[model samples]
Target: MFFAVALLLPAMAAADPLVGVWKTEPDRKNLISHIKITACGDKFCGKILSAYDATGKEVQTPNIGKKLFWDVSSEGSGKYGGGEFWVPLIDVDAVPQMTLQGDTLKVKGCEHVLCAHQTWSRLQS
Candidate 1:
Protein backbone atom coordinates (compact mmCIF):
# COMPACT_ATOMS: atom_id res chain seq x y z
CA MET A 1 0.00 0.00 0.00
CA PHE A 2 2.81 2.45 0.80
CA PHE A 3 4.56 1.83 -2.48
CA ALA A 4 1.33 2.14 -4.43
CA VAL A 5 0.52 5.49 -2.84
CA ALA A 6 3.94 6.91 -3.66
CA LEU A 7 3.55 6.03 -7.33
CA LEU A 8 0.17 7.71 -7.50
CA LEU A 9 1.34 11.02 -6.04
CA PRO A 10 3.58 11.96 -8.94
CA ALA A 11 0.90 11.19 -11.49
CA MET A 12 -1.58 13.42 -9.73
CA ALA A 13 0.83 16.34 -9.44
CA ALA A 14 1.63 16.23 -13.15
CA ALA A 15 -1.95 16.80 -14.23
CA ASP A 16 -2.19 20.45 -13.26
CA PRO A 17 -1.99 22.67 -16.38
CA LEU A 18 -1.74 26.13 -14.83
CA VAL A 19 1.78 25.95 -13.48
CA GLY A 20 3.67 28.43 -15.71
CA VAL A 21 3.71 31.72 -17.56
CA TRP A 22 1.54 32.25 -20.66
CA LYS A 23 1.90 34.72 -23.50
CA THR A 24 -0.74 35.88 -25.95
CA GLU A 25 0.05 35.46 -29.59
CA PRO A 26 -0.18 37.51 -32.87
CA ASP A 27 0.20 40.60 -30.74
CA ARG A 28 2.29 39.42 -27.83
CA LYS A 29 3.35 42.98 -27.17
CA ASN A 30 -0.05 43.90 -25.79
CA LEU A 31 -0.34 41.29 -23.06
CA ILE A 32 2.79 39.50 -21.96
CA SER A 33 2.37 38.11 -18.51
CA HIS A 34 3.08 35.20 -16.24
CA ILE A 35 0.42 33.22 -14.44
CA LYS A 36 1.66 31.43 -11.35
CA ILE A 37 -1.03 28.90 -10.48
CA THR A 38 -1.29 27.06 -7.19
CA ALA A 39 -3.83 25.32 -5.04
CA CYS A 40 -5.79 27.48 -2.63
CA GLY A 41 -7.72 25.47 -0.06
CA ASP A 42 -9.31 22.91 -2.43
CA LYS A 43 -9.57 25.51 -5.16
CA PHE A 44 -6.99 26.57 -7.74
CA CYS A 45 -5.98 30.17 -8.40
CA GLY A 46 -3.63 32.12 -10.64
CA LYS A 47 -1.97 35.54 -10.42
CA ILE A 48 -0.42 37.89 -12.88
CA LEU A 49 3.34 38.16 -12.73
CA SER A 50 3.93 41.08 -15.07
CA ALA A 51 1.76 42.73 -17.69
CA TYR A 52 2.48 45.32 -20.35
CA ASP A 53 0.29 47.28 -22.68
CA ALA A 54 0.52 47.50 -26.50
CA THR A 55 3.32 50.01 -26.36
CA GLY A 56 5.44 47.80 -24.06
CA LYS A 57 4.58 50.02 -21.15
CA GLU A 58 3.79 48.24 -17.90
CA VAL A 59 0.17 48.37 -16.94
CA GLN A 60 -0.77 49.34 -13.41
CA THR A 61 -4.18 47.77 -13.40
CA PRO A 62 -5.94 47.19 -10.10
CA ASN A 63 -6.05 43.47 -10.75
CA ILE A 64 -2.33 42.89 -11.03
CA GLY A 65 -2.19 40.68 -7.97
CA LYS A 66 -5.80 39.68 -8.03
CA LYS A 67 -6.92 36.12 -8.49
CA LEU A 68 -7.43 35.73 -12.20
CA PHE A 69 -8.43 32.09 -11.82
CA TRP A 70 -10.44 30.48 -9.10
CA ASP A 71 -13.18 28.01 -8.18
CA VAL A 72 -11.66 25.97 -10.96
CA SER A 73 -11.02 22.29 -10.67
CA SER A 74 -9.05 20.14 -13.00
CA GLU A 75 -11.29 17.87 -15.04
CA GLY A 76 -8.45 15.69 -16.24
CA SER A 77 -7.50 15.47 -19.93
CA GLY A 78 -5.72 18.84 -19.65
CA LYS A 79 -8.95 20.74 -19.04
CA TYR A 80 -10.25 23.02 -16.27
CA GLY A 81 -13.86 23.91 -15.52
CA GLY A 82 -16.08 25.95 -13.22
CA GLY A 83 -14.05 29.15 -13.38
CA GLU A 84 -14.39 32.67 -14.74
CA PHE A 85 -11.82 35.11 -16.10
CA TRP A 86 -11.79 38.89 -15.69
CA VAL A 87 -9.73 40.55 -18.37
CA PRO A 88 -9.32 44.22 -19.24
CA LEU A 89 -11.36 43.92 -22.40
CA ILE A 90 -15.09 43.60 -21.94
CA ASP A 91 -16.96 45.95 -19.69
CA VAL A 92 -19.54 43.44 -18.59
CA ASP A 93 -18.39 40.30 -16.81
CA ALA A 94 -18.25 37.12 -18.85
CA VAL A 95 -17.67 33.50 -18.10
CA PRO A 96 -16.05 31.23 -20.60
CA GLN A 97 -14.98 27.62 -20.90
CA MET A 98 -11.23 27.10 -20.58
CA THR A 99 -9.07 24.32 -21.96
CA LEU A 100 -5.37 23.45 -21.90
CA GLN A 101 -3.51 21.62 -24.64
CA GLY A 102 0.07 20.98 -23.63
CA ASP A 103 1.55 24.47 -23.23
CA THR A 104 -1.33 26.10 -25.05
CA LEU A 105 -4.45 27.35 -23.27
CA LYS A 106 -7.59 28.40 -25.07
CA VAL A 107 -10.62 30.28 -23.79
CA LYS A 108 -13.96 30.35 -25.58
CA GLY A 109 -16.87 32.67 -25.08
CA CYS A 110 -19.82 34.23 -26.86
CA GLU A 111 -20.37 37.80 -27.95
CA HIS A 112 -24.12 38.00 -28.39
CA VAL A 113 -23.88 34.22 -28.56
CA LEU A 114 -21.39 34.47 -31.38
CA CYS A 115 -18.21 32.44 -30.93
CA ALA A 116 -15.06 34.22 -29.80
CA HIS A 117 -11.71 32.79 -28.76
CA GLN A 118 -8.55 33.79 -26.89
CA THR A 119 -5.32 31.86 -27.04
CA TRP A 120 -2.41 31.80 -24.59
CA SER A 121 0.91 30.06 -24.93
CA ARG A 122 2.97 28.89 -22.01
CA LEU A 123 6.17 30.80 -21.38
CA GLN A 124 9.39 28.90 -21.13
CA SER A 125 10.73 28.32 -17.70
Candidate 2:
Protein backbone atom coordinates (compact mmCIF):
# COMPACT_ATOMS: atom_id res chain seq x y z
CA MET A 1 0.00 0.00 0.00
CA PHE A 2 2.76 2.43 0.93
CA PHE A 3 4.69 1.71 -2.25
CA ALA A 4 1.62 2.20 -4.39
CA VAL A 5 0.76 5.49 -2.74
CA ALA A 6 4.33 6.75 -3.08
CA LEU A 7 4.49 5.92 -6.77
CA LEU A 8 1.17 7.63 -7.48
CA LEU A 9 1.90 10.79 -5.51
CA PRO A 10 4.37 12.20 -8.02
CA ALA A 11 2.14 11.34 -10.95
CA MET A 12 -0.84 13.00 -9.34
CA ALA A 13 1.09 16.14 -8.60
CA ALA A 14 2.50 16.20 -12.09
CA ALA A 15 -0.97 15.97 -13.58
CA ASP A 16 -1.59 19.59 -12.60
CA PRO A 17 0.81 22.05 -14.11
CA LEU A 18 -0.05 24.65 -11.45
CA VAL A 19 1.29 22.53 -8.62
CA GLY A 20 4.57 24.27 -7.86
CA VAL A 21 6.27 27.19 -6.19
CA TRP A 22 5.72 30.71 -7.53
CA LYS A 23 7.58 33.94 -6.85
CA THR A 24 5.13 36.79 -6.42
CA GLU A 25 5.90 40.27 -7.64
CA PRO A 26 7.06 42.80 -5.10
CA ASP A 27 4.28 44.60 -3.27
CA ARG A 28 4.14 48.28 -2.44
CA LYS A 29 6.52 47.73 0.45
CA ASN A 30 9.00 46.00 -1.82
CA LEU A 31 8.32 42.67 -0.19
CA ILE A 32 8.28 39.54 -2.32
CA SER A 33 6.82 36.21 -1.26
CA HIS A 34 7.02 32.67 -2.54
CA ILE A 35 3.71 30.83 -2.70
CA LYS A 36 3.38 27.07 -3.02
CA ILE A 37 0.29 25.84 -4.80
CA THR A 38 -0.87 22.27 -4.28
CA ALA A 39 -3.86 20.06 -4.62
CA CYS A 40 -6.29 20.06 -1.69
CA GLY A 41 -8.95 17.42 -1.99
CA ASP A 42 -10.20 17.88 -5.59
CA LYS A 43 -9.39 21.60 -5.66
CA PHE A 44 -6.29 23.80 -5.48
CA CYS A 45 -4.81 25.85 -2.64
CA GLY A 46 -1.82 28.03 -1.99
CA LYS A 47 0.24 29.07 1.01
CA ILE A 48 3.15 31.29 1.70
CA LEU A 49 6.40 29.32 1.64
CA SER A 50 8.85 32.16 2.15
CA ALA A 51 9.37 35.92 1.87
CA TYR A 52 12.15 38.22 0.87
CA ASP A 53 13.03 41.87 0.74
CA ALA A 54 13.65 43.78 -2.47
CA THR A 55 17.35 42.94 -2.22
CA GLY A 56 16.61 39.17 -2.23
CA LYS A 57 17.19 38.68 1.49
CA GLU A 58 14.82 36.29 3.20
CA VAL A 59 12.61 37.77 5.87
CA GLN A 60 10.82 35.99 8.66
CA THR A 61 7.30 36.83 9.68
CA PRO A 62 4.42 35.34 11.61
CA ASN A 63 2.48 34.64 8.42
CA ILE A 64 5.15 32.53 6.75
CA GLY A 65 3.08 29.34 6.82
CA LYS A 66 -0.32 30.91 6.41
CA LYS A 67 -2.70 30.06 3.60
CA LEU A 68 -2.94 32.61 0.84
CA PHE A 69 -5.96 31.15 -0.89
CA TRP A 70 -8.05 27.98 -1.02
CA ASP A 71 -10.79 26.09 -2.81
CA VAL A 72 -9.63 27.13 -6.25
CA SER A 73 -10.55 24.98 -9.21
CA SER A 74 -9.61 25.19 -12.85
CA GLU A 75 -12.04 27.10 -15.07
CA GLY A 76 -10.57 25.77 -18.29
CA SER A 77 -8.27 27.65 -20.69
CA GLY A 78 -5.64 27.89 -17.97
CA LYS A 79 -7.94 30.02 -15.79
CA TYR A 80 -9.12 29.34 -12.25
CA GLY A 81 -11.55 30.80 -9.77
CA GLY A 82 -13.94 30.15 -6.86
CA GLY A 83 -11.51 30.92 -4.04
CA GLU A 84 -11.11 33.37 -1.22
CA PHE A 85 -7.90 35.26 -0.57
CA TRP A 86 -6.93 36.03 3.01
CA VAL A 87 -5.05 39.15 3.96
CA PRO A 88 -3.66 38.93 7.45
CA LEU A 89 -2.58 42.54 7.70
CA ILE A 90 -6.03 43.89 6.84
CA ASP A 91 -8.05 41.06 8.30
CA VAL A 92 -10.14 40.86 5.15
CA ASP A 93 -11.04 38.34 2.49
CA ALA A 94 -11.31 38.81 -1.25
CA VAL A 95 -12.61 36.71 -4.07
CA PRO A 96 -9.77 35.49 -6.23
CA GLN A 97 -9.41 34.77 -9.95
CA MET A 98 -6.29 33.41 -11.59
CA THR A 99 -4.99 32.83 -15.10
CA LEU A 100 -1.97 30.73 -15.82
CA GLN A 101 0.08 31.79 -18.85
CA GLY A 102 3.12 29.68 -19.49
CA ASP A 103 5.50 30.49 -16.61
CA THR A 104 3.46 33.47 -15.41
CA LEU A 105 0.40 33.28 -13.23
CA LYS A 106 -1.92 36.27 -13.10
CA VAL A 107 -3.68 36.56 -9.76
CA LYS A 108 -6.46 39.00 -9.00
CA GLY A 109 -8.47 39.76 -5.89
CA CYS A 110 -11.60 41.81 -5.47
CA GLU A 111 -13.80 42.92 -2.61
CA HIS A 112 -16.78 45.04 -3.55
CA VAL A 113 -15.52 47.88 -5.69
CA LEU A 114 -11.85 47.48 -4.93
CA CYS A 115 -9.58 45.07 -6.75
CA ALA A 116 -5.90 44.28 -6.97
CA HIS A 117 -3.81 42.25 -9.35
CA GLN A 118 -0.38 40.70 -9.32
CA THR A 119 1.71 38.67 -11.72
CA TRP A 120 3.76 35.85 -10.24
CA SER A 121 6.49 33.87 -11.98
CA ARG A 122 7.07 30.16 -11.64
CA LEU A 123 9.97 29.25 -9.37
CA GLN A 124 12.15 26.68 -11.04
CA SER A 125 13.59 24.02 -8.81
Candidate 3:
Protein backbone atom coordinates (compact mmCIF):
# COMPACT_ATOMS: atom_id res chain seq x y z
CA MET A 1 0.00 0.00 0.00
CA PHE A 2 2.78 2.41 0.90
CA PHE A 3 4.61 1.80 -2.33
CA ALA A 4 1.50 2.35 -4.40
CA VAL A 5 0.68 5.61 -2.64
CA ALA A 6 4.23 6.86 -2.97
CA LEU A 7 4.28 6.23 -6.69
CA LEU A 8 0.90 7.89 -7.12
CA LEU A 9 1.93 11.09 -5.37
CA PRO A 10 4.41 12.14 -8.02
CA ALA A 11 1.99 11.31 -10.79
CA MET A 12 -0.74 13.39 -9.15
CA ALA A 13 1.54 16.37 -8.70
CA ALA A 14 2.74 16.19 -12.27
CA ALA A 15 -0.83 16.11 -13.52
CA ASP A 16 -1.24 19.72 -12.42
CA PRO A 17 0.50 22.22 -14.63
CA LEU A 18 1.36 24.53 -11.72
CA VAL A 19 2.51 21.89 -9.29
CA GLY A 20 6.23 22.52 -8.78
CA VAL A 21 8.72 24.81 -7.12
CA TRP A 22 9.17 28.25 -8.62
CA LYS A 23 11.87 30.85 -8.01
CA THR A 24 10.98 34.49 -7.76
CA GLU A 25 12.97 37.32 -9.26
CA PRO A 26 15.20 39.28 -6.93
CA ASP A 27 13.38 41.89 -4.92
CA ARG A 28 14.53 45.47 -4.48
CA LYS A 29 16.82 44.25 -1.72
CA ASN A 30 18.05 41.46 -4.00
CA LEU A 31 16.31 38.80 -1.98
CA ILE A 32 14.77 35.84 -3.77
CA SER A 33 12.40 33.12 -2.63
CA HIS A 34 11.22 29.75 -3.88
CA ILE A 35 7.54 28.89 -3.72
CA LYS A 36 6.13 25.39 -3.94
CA ILE A 37 2.69 25.19 -5.46
CA THR A 38 0.52 22.21 -4.70
CA ALA A 39 -3.02 21.01 -4.45
CA CYS A 40 -5.07 22.52 -1.64
CA GLY A 41 -8.47 20.90 -1.39
CA ASP A 42 -10.06 21.50 -4.78
CA LYS A 43 -7.99 24.60 -5.50
CA PHE A 44 -4.26 25.37 -5.38
CA CYS A 45 -1.98 26.92 -2.80
CA GLY A 46 1.66 27.89 -2.58
CA LYS A 47 4.09 28.06 0.29
CA ILE A 48 7.59 29.40 0.56
CA LEU A 49 10.22 26.73 0.20
CA SER A 50 13.41 28.77 0.65
CA ALA A 51 14.79 32.25 0.70
CA TYR A 52 18.10 33.84 -0.28
CA ASP A 53 19.62 37.18 0.58
CA ALA A 54 21.49 39.65 -1.63
CA THR A 55 24.70 37.65 -1.30
CA GLY A 56 22.89 34.57 -2.65
CA LYS A 57 23.14 32.93 0.74
CA GLU A 58 20.30 30.86 2.07
CA VAL A 59 18.53 32.45 5.04
CA GLN A 60 15.88 31.60 7.58
CA THR A 61 12.80 33.76 7.60
CA PRO A 62 9.47 33.86 9.39
CA ASN A 63 7.69 33.62 6.06
CA ILE A 64 9.23 30.26 5.28
CA GLY A 65 6.55 27.56 4.95
CA LYS A 66 3.84 30.15 5.14
CA LYS A 67 1.11 30.08 2.53
CA LEU A 68 1.63 32.94 0.13
CA PHE A 69 -0.93 31.85 -2.40
CA TRP A 70 -4.31 30.28 -1.68
CA ASP A 71 -7.61 29.34 -3.21
CA VAL A 72 -6.37 29.77 -6.75
CA SER A 73 -8.70 28.30 -9.38
CA SER A 74 -7.85 27.41 -12.93
CA GLU A 75 -9.47 29.48 -15.65
CA GLY A 76 -8.49 27.17 -18.48
CA SER A 77 -5.30 27.00 -20.53
CA GLY A 78 -2.52 28.42 -18.35
CA LYS A 79 -4.59 31.13 -16.69
CA TYR A 80 -5.57 31.05 -13.04
CA GLY A 81 -7.68 33.46 -11.05
CA GLY A 82 -9.58 34.10 -7.81
CA GLY A 83 -6.64 33.58 -5.57
CA GLU A 84 -5.85 35.29 -2.31
CA PHE A 85 -2.19 36.26 -2.13
CA TRP A 86 -0.36 37.22 1.00
CA VAL A 87 2.34 39.87 1.09
CA PRO A 88 4.88 39.18 3.79
CA LEU A 89 6.28 42.68 3.83
CA ILE A 90 3.15 44.52 4.90
CA ASP A 91 1.13 41.46 5.90
CA VAL A 92 -1.70 42.26 3.54
CA ASP A 93 -3.92 40.04 1.40
CA ALA A 94 -4.71 40.73 -2.21
CA VAL A 95 -6.61 39.08 -5.02
CA PRO A 96 -4.47 37.84 -7.84
CA GLN A 97 -4.62 36.48 -11.36
CA MET A 98 -1.90 34.21 -12.68
CA THR A 99 -0.84 32.98 -16.10
CA LEU A 100 1.79 30.42 -16.93
CA GLN A 101 3.95 30.37 -20.07
CA GLY A 102 6.49 27.64 -20.48
CA ASP A 103 8.78 27.90 -17.48
CA THR A 104 7.52 31.30 -16.42
CA LEU A 105 4.57 32.21 -14.22
CA LYS A 106 3.25 35.73 -14.13
CA VAL A 107 1.11 37.00 -11.25
CA LYS A 108 -0.79 40.22 -10.77
CA GLY A 109 -2.27 41.00 -7.39
CA CYS A 110 -4.52 43.89 -6.63
CA GLU A 111 -5.54 45.54 -3.41
CA HIS A 112 -8.31 47.88 -4.30
CA VAL A 113 -7.01 49.87 -7.23
CA LEU A 114 -3.36 49.21 -6.46
CA CYS A 115 -1.84 46.33 -8.34
CA ALA A 116 1.54 44.60 -8.14
CA HIS A 117 3.11 42.24 -10.64
CA GLN A 118 5.68 39.49 -10.29
CA THR A 119 7.25 37.03 -12.71
CA TRP A 120 8.57 33.73 -11.42
CA SER A 121 10.76 31.12 -13.07
CA ARG A 122 10.33 27.38 -12.64
CA LEU A 123 12.96 25.68 -10.52
CA GLN A 124 14.35 22.54 -12.12
CA SER A 125 13.93 19.59 -9.83
lDDT of 2 by residue, 17-84 (tens): 78899999987778899999988855788999999998999999887999999988878789989889
- Give lDDT tens digits, candidate 1, residues 1-125: 99888777545544455666677543333566656666654446667776777677777766568666666667777677666655545543345566888778886654356555778888852
What lDDT would each prediction earn against the true structure?
0.63, 0.87, 0.86
Q: Model 1: runs farther than 4 Å from truth?
A: 1-15, 25-29, 55-57, 109-116
> For model 3, which pairs clash?
none
| Native-to-model Cα distance after best TM-score fit, residue 38 in candidate 3, in Å | 0.2
Candidate 3, residue 42: the lDDT equals 54
Each candidate structure's count of clashing pairs: 0, 0, 0
C-alpha root-mean-square deviation, candidate 3:
4.8
TM-scores of all predicted structures:
0.65, 0.86, 0.85
Among residues 3 or more apart in sequence or in different chains, the pairs in candidate 1 whose N, CA or C atoms overlap within 3 Å are: none
User: Each prediction's Cα RMSD?
Assistant: 4.6, 4.2, 4.8
Clashing pairs in 2: none
**Model 1, CA-based lDDT:** 0.63
